[model samples]
Target: MITGPLCRAARALTELSREKLAALSGVDEHVIELFERRIAAPDANVVAMLKSTLEDMGAVFIPEDRRGAGVRLKFTASETKRIATLESEGGLIRGDDVP
Candidate 1:
């Protein structure tokens, strides 16, 4: 299930405008706007279409876990290595300083 924020994040990750997403998913642009605004819940079919379109575009939806639900990009090995390099260089945080 795609939550509002997750849907928004997926769109952002894919560099998709609301109009583009609507065109791809066959959902109305206004409905997508309302969904992202958290003002309305779309029908299950709409949700499915959004998810399918995003997945086809390389967005993976993480199921709710202890940390929470989220969306992530499906990266290639070189991209994964680049992210690992950044993390190893202290470009990312692991929360070790949290009290």
Candidate 2:
């Protein structure tokens, strides 16, 4: 289960507004606001819906552990491909000269 803080953080990372999230998740904007503000708790199903929608938009939810739960953005397919291509480019490794 995700916490209210996680939800808010995920939304920020995904650059999604409450209205936009509500529309995408089919949840009420007021419910999302209240939930994020820690004012009210919505149904479990509603929370799941929000989580799924955010994930689809690139928000990756980190499970709770010793360091605590968090949220991050997943790299898009194009980004992954570009990174792989760059990694496959064999070149001499050199240290940067800084003084």
- Whole-model Cα lDDT of every candidate shown, in order: 0.91, 0.92
- Predicted candidate 2 versus true structure: per-residue lDDT over 1-99, tens digit per residue: 777788999999999999999999999999999999999999999999999999999999988889988899999999999999999798877889887
The estimated TM-scores of all candidates read 0.75, 0.86
For model 1, how does the per-residue alpha-carbon lDDT over 1-99 read when each residue is reduced to its tens digit? Answer: 797788999999989999999999899999998998899999988999999999988899999989999999999779999998977996655668757
lDDT of 2 at 6: 86
Question: Of the candidates shown, which would achieve the greatest lDDT relative to the real structure?
Answer: 2
Tell me the spans in candidate 2 whose CA falls farther than 4 Å from its real position.
90-99
| Reference-based lDDT, residue 29, model 2 | 96
lDDT at residue 78 of model 2 (Cα atoms): 100
